[model samples]
Target: MSLLTDLKHDEQFNASEKAVAQYIITNKEEVLNLSIQALSELTYTSPSTVVRLCRKIGLKGFKDFKIKWSAELQKEYNAISNVDPDFPFTDDDSYGEIQKKILELFTDSLNQTSQLLSPDKLERAVELLLQADKIGVFAYGDTYLPALNFQNKLMKIDRSVHMAALPGENRHLATNFRQGDCAIVISYSGESKNNYYITQLLKQNGATIIVITGNPSSHIASLGDLILPVAESESQSVKLSTFSSQTAIDYVLNTLYGCLFVSNYDKNQSKRIASETLFLDERF
Candidate 1:
């Protein structure tokens, strides 16, 4: 039996579900990355109680809960932070004030994205990316900036990645892709026709699709093999560029890169050595 399943029948721990849930919601940030003993201590419960709590909630174990809890807490924080200020806390015309406001919006967006993530979704996306033969990335308008940055990061890790940065070239470039590949589409609203088309084409070619979008139920969601929800602009009064969406994309890209590094550390060593040698002339 799973460790959590074994602990479910314990009477002493049966009534603590509400308390455990509250503890998780309150101390999510601190204990989100914590071990079982650390979480138990933080929650003012015994390790066995923590284990039992996992069973109650239907998680495999404490580690599984950590991923889901951390994501939910981050999402909650993001949704709160992105909403526009009610009044002029700082004047919008002031450069310093504008900078601070932008920071708040992006930070909130990143937080919300994390909270909405499920452990199963994150794990499944990671598995797809790691196993894919090739990866294609695309974004339109503002989303393209982060897509370009993501492509660069993956290239540094020696991943075979392609991106569409030129006009009228996205479709032609995308058409060359085949099965066993992956397509990562980034859109703030997940409403872009171009992105939706790309996703549909990729799927038709037997490629797995990963969509990062602010709208979970948008048309592109249907095309996605995995849906990653970023934060959309929360201000109804002002037209703000999609800063938070890009920030969330940054976090996901970094997390995926770290996972890939760990999975291919030995192979990467040879690649890194060859890269350093090839660039030796530029170094001098």
Candidate 2:
């Protein structure tokens, strides 16, 4: 489990212990440089509370917690330093410079996403998708393109998948969802009100929910039966468009499609070849 997930879900932690855990999560970089006393002072808790929090989370002590936290932080820092996803190229940048920066941004996004991805969660998602009677993809705004891409890929493999980028169509689809179905929602912020409503309706119909988001702590992520977290570049300026988020989403969808393709390789391949032949015959 992620440290944030553990902190959020563990019922054994008291208020003070949770407070220390939250402090560590929010100020991980600073916590790496602080002593137990310093951390306790910052969190307004006792040193004993800090130690207890660490132990509860399966860390040996404050030092162990700091070491693990620091490692994760370092990985994030390296990814961010490699690229600024929002403004990867500027007007002053030459064509070569722009190409190099875009390549760096894509590489960094994939690398960081690989680091953050949980193998168990991925396997679980695959299992659900394979067994689902129908797959419904939901996304809005910038994420809709990737959602449509995913739907197209799944359709080629003879899977029952549905997606609607528009709100009215999406609402109709969500209402029609049944038990044993699965809904995959793509949202970078993981806080879209429309998504939340659609997810609720799906849940009411007993469909399994898979959420792909850059924000792990968002409410939408908490509702997911399976959560796929993507790495996001930390930039000081607000982003007007999503670059890394879309890249990460595409990577995840492609990976999932690959898994599905391999599961019934002979059948899927034959179907794909037949489909290609038919299309070619018509065109020719």
Candidate 3:
């Protein structure tokens, strides 16, 4: 029987032990590389209890148990592998197939966000974004690419905007924010410790926050003044995927820019366009 099936019959364990064991089994996909100490803290069980549990399960010790458990989880995940969007797609795929995939991803994402996103939350978010005198964006991994794109887009319209191209471990750029500033944080899982600490620091200083994440329930979401949910599709082979989430973020930025343009309708668009056209010769 699987660990899950075996657990249903193992009523000998106390509630706490049972809980710890279940967490370890259920999270094998996420915790395979974790050491016993890390797993102990994650499962909230003592190291001794962890070892004892492994022996009880007929394993030699914690290390052997974790490896076996991880193998089982991997086998199970492999069976459902096709469900993840990171599956290989040839560059020569028909345009229709690409279009259909994109539509399906975004359509489901929109529906989910529509159901979960409240009108009051959006109003509060927009108000914060509009009121900010400065903006700081921080992201890492695949997420940083989108942050750079957003920074460039924002800078084109607002010269005063500051983009932290790379926020290292210390998040040194976080200190530049002031009371009227806003911090825009992006993370696929919404759980990067560095980003989370930056959010906490910004909030403590009275800065508004905008968080874009694939997992809305993640720790980073709780700190956001505005939460933007991105769609995610994961796989066992490929550890992470960015296609759908990046598309969603780009759409949000475009919408916000449109709103800004409408709000500045009284300003002359021709002058702004001309100011950006300095590279072209007068003959053109």
Candidate 4:
């Protein structure tokens, strides 16, 4: 994991450590040139606190932390300088430029997500899905499409998947989940109150919950039994479109579908082919 990702995901850091981390993240370029005492003074902490923060993040000391952080920052700078993932195209961009920018946004989003994905967490999520008696997918707004797509994919493989976009219907479906069942919740911010309540309801029923979210520190993420973290560049634009989050969610769901399909490859392939054949026959 990158130091920034680790700082975000790891909750063991105390207030002082987090403060130091935030300072380092915000002042990445300047950190490499600052002495331990200088950094501590800048962050309103002490040199010992800085050293402790470094140790907590798996670095030997301030020097090692600077070295690793500098390298990571350089890589990030080079990547973003090529194509700004968050705002790849502007209002004045030409048609061809817009197309190219959109492509770059999606490609970079997937690559960043892939780099941060944890194989162990993915395997565990698949195991939970395979063991569940029923699966419920939950999402709101723009994320609902990917959730529905995942439901359709699972249904093709003969898995019972349920999803509800409405609040009352979501609650109803969540309430029906029992022990040995699983709920897959998709939310980029992981702060939707509706999804939070739904996840709470699933927990109340003793069902396992898998959360696919971009924010690791969100409340919904904390409630998850298994979390699929999606890394993307943060954006504050009020644009109607959400590019990176949706792409990340789709990629994670597709990866999960692939893993599930391969777990029982022969049976799944037969079922999928048979389903397609039946549909074609009905249509023709």
Candidate 5:
């Protein structure tokens, strides 16, 4: 929990400490620019009392409190509302405004993706991956970014995942994969002809297919054994870039990677470091 949260509910604080806490919480904007002595003066408390309150929240002194508190304030400030992911900023927007809008879009996309996530589907997907004889990921273009990322992390934990980023190369994986194997198809639109051909081959070979796409009703999504929704608050083509879809895809894949790691936490955690040391020389 944050220091502010502790101040509001930590019952051990006495009247003087509570008064200092109240002043800090109420005058957050002022506190951002306040010194330790100035804060004590405003709360009508001694400097020693302010230091005590800081220690109560696990901080060493007033400087530590101010730096952490400033970060919390900045996080709250970035959480804006009603920001359309498509065309989030105008042509005339300044560089700082563009940066803020992009951050807002990412925050909004992560929330939306979490809302659409299904616990049952997630459990089932993880179970299939755990039992699969082999695993392959099919993605091209922008979606290939997350496919490559997932493959990298999974490899560190000793889960070998095949991902072919080049066009004709993925066809080989789809065609050669076996009946008990698993295939993850990442296509934001769920209507890519490129993905559709490979999807057919995977189905023909009796591989279990997991689809991550924006449109649940689209052709590719309809073919999957399990479908996970993609958060697509932005337009498919008329937008500045593939911001929302990419963010949501990365979020979903990362969540899957986390769950996979936790399934065998102790071994996986140690194995990751061992893998890095064995395969990488400069990691330290």
Candidate 6:
């Protein structure tokens, strides 16, 4: 992601940092040669505030931010993605063409999601999963399906995971979770009411939070310890369907499941074998 892109998406910025970010984004060309003091002065914030913003976005300081920002501006970046996440197909398309578009849409969605879900975040999520006493999966609507799939995988692996997505029961689940427990909350917008409330409960209860979302600039994302962002291409309110978002969620959950399995490779393999054997008698 570009420096501006990070500034726009990441919700971790404070009010002062946000002011500096707005200035930098609105005056991109001006920032090319701008110093910390000058940029801060333009934004009416301090140089320290500018440096803090720089650090929040993973840069060491103003110089480091400048180095990365300059390189990104100089580099030729690609168009958003090969396929449009929202409108991958049209009314004029034949079934054959639609099939091709569907395939490509999923391909593109997974690619974008993989890029957004950085390796360090993935590693941290898995680390938390390994450390947690129990795991709870929370989501609403379309996002819940991927959470269920992940829950099933965790259960099969002998990991104690619960689907807390049931209506009216998330609060109960949240309260029940212990300090060492983990909550995997999935929401594309990152601002659902139930998710926000339940996440708040989880937070107070001292459970670790791992948020899977598309929008990082959201209240839920701020409450999370680890945020695994999905493809940011799909519009929150407008879309042909949940195709791209669903695909992205599934990819991220499956990646997590696969990573967890690989973390304890031999033990998980044996567990899978044992699980298969238990179901072997059901020929139907």
- List the RMSD of every prediction in angstroms: 17.0, 18.7, 17.7, 17.7, 11.6, 20.1
Query: Model-by-model lDDT, in order?
Result: 0.69, 0.81, 0.66, 0.84, 0.86, 0.84
Put down candidate 5 lDDT per residue, 1-284, tens digits, no spaces. Answer: 87769888848888888999988777766787888888888888889998898898999988988999888766755654577777788864545456778888898899888988888878989998999999999998888998899999999898999987566899987888878999999989999998998999999889999999988888999889999897867666787778889999999999999989998999999997887687788655
lDDT of 5 at 154: 95
Where's the lowest-lDDT run of ten residues in candidate 3? 80-89
- Candidate scoring better on TM-score of 4 and 5: 5
Best by lDDT: 5
Candidate 2 lDDT (Cα, 0 to 1): 0.81
* Winning model by TM-score: 5
In order of listing, the candidates' clash counts read 8, 0, 0, 0, 0, 0
Write down the TM-score of every candidate: 0.62, 0.68, 0.58, 0.68, 0.70, 0.68
lDDT comparison, 1 vs 6, better candidate:
6
- Screening candidate 3 with a backbone cut-off below 3 angstroms (N, C-alpha, C), the clashing residue pairs are none
What is candidate 2's lDDT per residue for 33-144, written digit by digit as tens? 8999998998899999989988988999889988877676555444444556877767754444556667778888888898888778778889999999988898887788
* lDDT comparison, 4 vs 5, better candidate: 5
Clashes of 1: 8
Clash list (residue pairs), candidate 4: none
How high is the lDDT of residue 237 in model 6?
Answer: 72
lDDT of 6 by residue, 58-145 (tens): 8899999888876775452222236566787777454444666688788878888888888898899999999998888888888878
User: What are the clashing pairs of model 5?
Assistant: none
Off by over 4 Å in 1: 1-96, 234-238, 269-281
lDDT of 4 by residue, 1-284 (tens): 89989777548888888888888766667788899999889889999999998898889999998889878865654454356655667765544456666777788789989987778888998999989988889888888888889888988898878887565798888899999998998878888888899889999889999999988789999999988999757564565478878898999999999989999999999999999999999984
For model 5, the superposed segments whose C-alpha errors exceed 4 Å read 1-80, 276-284
